[model samples]
Target: MPTENALPQRLTPVLEARFGLDGGAMFGIIPQPLWSRTNPPDDNNRIDMACRCLLLEYPDRNVLIDTGIGTKWSDKERSIYKIDDQDPGMTDSLEARQLEPADIDDVILTHLHFDHVGGASRVDEQGDIVATFPDARHWVQDRNWSWAMNPSERDAGSYRKEDYSFFESNPDAPPLKLIDGISEILPGVEVLPLHGHTFGMQAVKITTDEHTFIYLADLIPTTSHLRAPYVMGYDLQPLETVEEKKEMLYHADRNDWILFFEHDPKQAFARLDFDDDTPRAVPVNPDEISAIG
Candidate 1:
């Protein structure tokens, strides 16, 4: 269902998987009953989560943003995440769009977290590690480049040695690490970095003559987090997230920005609003997402 405005845009999903984790863990300190009303959980107490990655076909490049959790996990790990080897999964979505593994030109990682960057690599014929996109350059922020290579003990799980070893081995593969501030990676698109959840995590901002849309990455995981105080516990600096959201939402409200959500299962883009000028979201379905904005 497209919005009132027709934005001719194509969004391909690299993955479509669900997880069952504690509802409390999903929304941090938010009360269970209130959040549950919006997102209900299962018998195991974990709510169904959507791990979606987007592939954008710009005129010149096949730019993909974020790679959902890859299939490099063990049976034990699979059981832990409750990985469903069923329909609506990553491969299914890719095939539906008539895309193959080698079709991607560039993988734009929003951050180094496992869920975001896992699909960056895949195992090859020789049992040797290899980049998922052999011909595509992998993009990351300069600050996060070092941070991921040398992650702290507390965050080591997010950057597994096995996953990144492929990059270290492939000397010729392009590494599109950002060298300057607020750079443009695609036409009519800009990378705006704001640190709160992870250092150097950038939200892609795309503007057209008619409207503006910002891919509010993890900044606003779901519409449930639209309110300023709904920062996730996983964020390193919650107060910083508050400030960042305040600035983003203020601009979103004034400019009538259509925000593209990363983790929201049903809706991808939304036009933001607030009864009292606070940050809120109006769902924008795929049909409504125009190439213009």
Candidate 2:
């Protein structure tokens, strides 16, 4: 186990891709008049979303929290999602930091959703799908992997076979390590499994001596979802989601943990304010944290 001071030296938000999703589905039962106030929808009823990933820099290794949606979409699919990969995208973000895909030491996948894990593999010049981080070990929950393999009809469309099929088909691919339950996959890094949005979806908790950070995957996709009732319609178990949010938010508020939102288009990090009837997220600048350069 790593001591308190042995936590990551730096944290970087890797902006991968920009896309859009149905605002109605994203806000669940929230009235359009309410949600549209914050996240205005496009003519197609889609709201802007970001596939943000986190990069943790340690003394000996660089760990990536998630791989955003990769470059493997057809013209029809791109138009539907309003996919945009050119502006400060994954490759450009990495290059700006003087790093390459091969430099990643480990990949902690929050879940196997197409938008989350699509960048894990890519279609090479030779036209073969292969691991993007060839040298890194990809970590995923065992139950989530099983669920992705045989997804329910409700979310079957979210799982793209081509995005992850290379893991099993390619013998020479990087190792895929499936973990069970809450486990510390790295020093000072822990993963907690939440099943409301999707079976076995994991949220990462990184602890340091001075501060703690929680990578809120789809559990709390955006700051607008800080309210207990703002669960997404895509969630299979809304009640479970509410209960889970209550517990997570209680701890987060009590501990003053900074939350990293994956799908929030405007805000990347925030601290909670529970003084109001509906919990509010106070936006925190990523540059404010010395360790999060």
Candidate 3:
């Protein structure tokens, strides 16, 4: 049970699929030796990553942040990314909290990347990909929606049409709400658009009277990325990513915002410490804050 000073009763982290990415690509120009010390790479030079989502439970509506990589991968594709077969995935995570997909009222997709939004839909029994949360209204940036529909050559592979096309083709599926720029989708849930990652990838900011939690989607994928220059090579605009990260980090440190990492493998939530020249992500035990279920 959570104490009075712990995380608000409504927030929990919903873990999804586990996958791996190339260490070099993940850390960009950072030397292998420097990054390998913390995030040791496997024989295949891949580092572990987790598709962790944030779930906000409310009396009237339940909200879910980015869904993980869905179960639509072929064996070859799974092998390429080194996806862990043992991960209990989204359904199990939700069941642990005594909720189902239908219970989710809104889904704020940080972006349309396969790893982030893949679980938004699934392959139905009739051999068709369908929306996973039939009752939830999916929210995404309009700029990002257009970019994903027609991605550039550099990031074409990241956008999987099958993962989200169902929302457009199937009228029975829940509505896909596309918003422009930053806006409050819900009363206290606001989506801030950041372009350094993809085109218009948004980071979710959930504010309460006493706490402010920012779901740092791919902007700051992991705790290791706390350093300004440790930007991912996967980012389209690496320099832009550095500036964006620095600004976000400064504000997060000053305001003492709890950052929810989407791709961090081991650590789920962290608070920034700016005592040193560089800001560091001090991992906070989810149990201490009652932030994970």
Candidate 4:
């Protein structure tokens, strides 16, 4: 196997969906004035965020990282989160690259939160919920699945049973692979679990030749969340999130990991930098990237 920081043979960034959320809740303890400067909010104090997913084109399989907030919500529900219906979604995104949902062989869900796993399934003409990627195996942590089955009062609202009900209702549905601990779920793709945000929220570490790309799901949703203490109030274990941020940031800086953000509006892929002993996330210009390495 290649060593750390290996670059991938092929990778593409796909913007599946976008939403606007309350700025205060997104930044948690950070003041609006401070966070708003980098991420300007709308008239209602809402910040724009993208449900971006990574598409890996390998010889054996085409893998998708997260499925974004899907089209399963009522108009009222969409209005509440300010989900943009005009934007191209997961299917549209895949079509742009000359591929269909059926072409996806695997989907690695960071967790089962609506925004992250909503697109995993969708409603058909008969109004029955079905797996969006009909031929793909959806991978999620066993611990996280158990927690979502019986969620705590604190996070019950985030767990929408309707989104994943297809799995329970269909006995012969597409495969739902339950993973355990950190392992290479796919060739060169490693899943690392971290608590504090949710029960088993995971970050995907992709090893490419001479480069390591980390998909920061909710662990560090946006660039503004680079600071250790700026964790979201939505986190089940806020303090644990903070601790994980510190350790992850340090590891990124030391190893030159390519950090990918799932929710940042303008910035998506970046590298961790340090100035005067302070760690910071510096965005990478796509033009500068010749490959995943």
Count clashes in each candidate, considering only residues at least 3 apart in sequence or on different chains: 8, 0, 0, 11
Q: Compared with the true structure, what per-residue lDDT tens digits does model 4 show for residues 28-100?
A: 8898878988999998888999998899876556889989888998989888888984566777777877889
Best by TM-score: 2
TM-score head-to-head 1 vs 3, winner: 3
Give the alpha carbon lDDT tens digit for every residue of 1-293 in model 2. 65434778788888898899999999999999999999999999999999999988887788999999998889999999999977588777877778899999999999999899999988889999989999999999999999999998889999988887788989989999999999998887999999999989999998765679999999999988988889999998999999989989989988899999999997888888866567888988767788786
Task: Report lDDT (Cα) of residue 49, candidate 2.
Answer: 95
Whole-structure CA lDDT of model 1: 0.71
Q: Candidate 1 — which residues are off by over 4 angstroms?
A: 1-9, 12-15, 172-176, 208-210, 290-293
Candidate 3 local Cα displacement, residue 92, angstroms: 1.1
Error of 3 at 143 (Å): 0.4
lDDT per residue, candidate 3, 136-240, as tens digits?
Answer: 999999999999999989899999999888888887989999999989888778899999988999998888656788999999999999898899998999888
Query: How many Å off is the CA of 58 in candidate 4?
Result: 0.2
**lDDT, model 2, position 177:** 94
Runs with alpha carbons beyond 4 Å of true place in candidate 4: 1-8
Give me the displacement of residue 109 in model 4, in angstroms. 0.3
What is the C-alpha local distance difference test score of each model? 0.71, 0.90, 0.87, 0.85
Compute the lDDT for candidate 4: 0.85
